[model samples]
Target chain A: SQTIHQWPATLVQPVGSPLSLECTVEGTSNPNLYWYRQAAGRGLQLLFYSIGIDQISSEVPQNLSASRPQDRQFILSSKKLLLSDSGFYLCAWSVQSYTEAFFGQGTRLTVV
Target chain B: TQLLEQSPQFLSIQEGENLTVYCNSSSVFSSLQWYRQEPGEGPVLLVTVVTGGEVKKLKRLTFQFGDARKDSSLHITAAQPGDTGLYLCAGKNGSSNTGKLIFGQGTTLQVKP
Candidate 1:
């Protein structure tokens, strides 16, 4: 069985601080990884997705960026955080671009 | 840009009642999926519809994909409090292989016991 591990279940940081969220997948190789953000209880906004190492596609222009250092390790980072950057971040992995994806426990980041 | 529009952003219903959630899009999709998310958790995939006009049932939940592959619907029979959660519709564009999935705004469903 494949499992995704995402960290810092909850985070509180002051404005202008840096952000680093990590996600890793086990039991799968060369899987498609994605990062998403959700505001309040609404839908998820695609942040970034990677097909392979060093191949990242960003959906929106924002303060955040993503990198896939290894086949199963993906990281989301920001040089400086904004108040609008506060939200629930999720990480997911799928076998194919059109297949069902498995998600990790999301991180709730509060920028004050 | 491809986008999906989900109807009834929020729904509150009584137990034992039936409800249907709809997701529509003008752009064609190769596949559509439905997911359920509880509070403080990530969305879980409930079902995936690949063929147009395809219907799949999981217990009390029935999902249907439009013949054009641009729309889908989810119907829940005998709603239970356990069914209270957020429902999301996601579409996979036929042309994109980057796996750039597009999501609907999502519908929040609350079933009161």
Candidate 2:
């Protein structure tokens, strides 16, 4: 079975610091990747998605950016993190854009 | 932009009780999906409703889509503590079924034993 992996299960960063969250998929090649964020006990908001290597589409303009350097590796980065950047960041992958996406364990970020 | 409005943002009930969560919208969709997420895990696919007014059942869970293709609902029969989680509904954004989904606000269900 295919699985998605995310790093830094928990993170605490000060304001104006940099941020990086990595997500990778194993056992699946050329899968569609996505990034989603959710506030505590709230709904999920689409942040970014990638179709293939070097192809990234951002939905919300914020202090975050995404990049797909490899077929199954996606990285979310930010040079300067804002207080609003604090949330649960999730990474997901699907067989294609329209299919059911498999999600990773997620990264919990807290900015002070 | 497509927006999904889910009702009953939070529900706390006893085990064995029946409940329903609704997802409504003015925009029509080609497909709608149901997902359940635990406290710290990712959302797991429960079922997907495609045709208008379509109904699908999964053991104790029943899912239905609106006839207008603009809404959906999830009904649980004799809910259990194991069914406690955040329920979310998602659908194809627009004409293209090959794009990111627009997710509902989600319903947080808490079933006590």
Candidate 2 local Cα displacement, residue B56, angstroms: 1.1
Per-residue lDDT of B1-113 in model 1, one digit per residue for the tens? 98999988999999999999999999999999999998888999999999999999999999999999999999999999999999999999898876667899999999999
- Candidate 2 clash pair list: none
Cα lDDT of model 2 by residue, A1-112, tens digit: 8988899899999999999999999998888899999988777898998888998988878889999999999999999999999999999888875658778998999999
Where does model 1 exceed 4 Å of error? none
Look at candidate 1 and give me any clashing residue pairs. Answer: none
CA shift of A36, model 1, Å? 0.5
Top candidate, metric DockQ: 1
Best by lDDT: 1
Top-scoring candidate (TM-score): 1
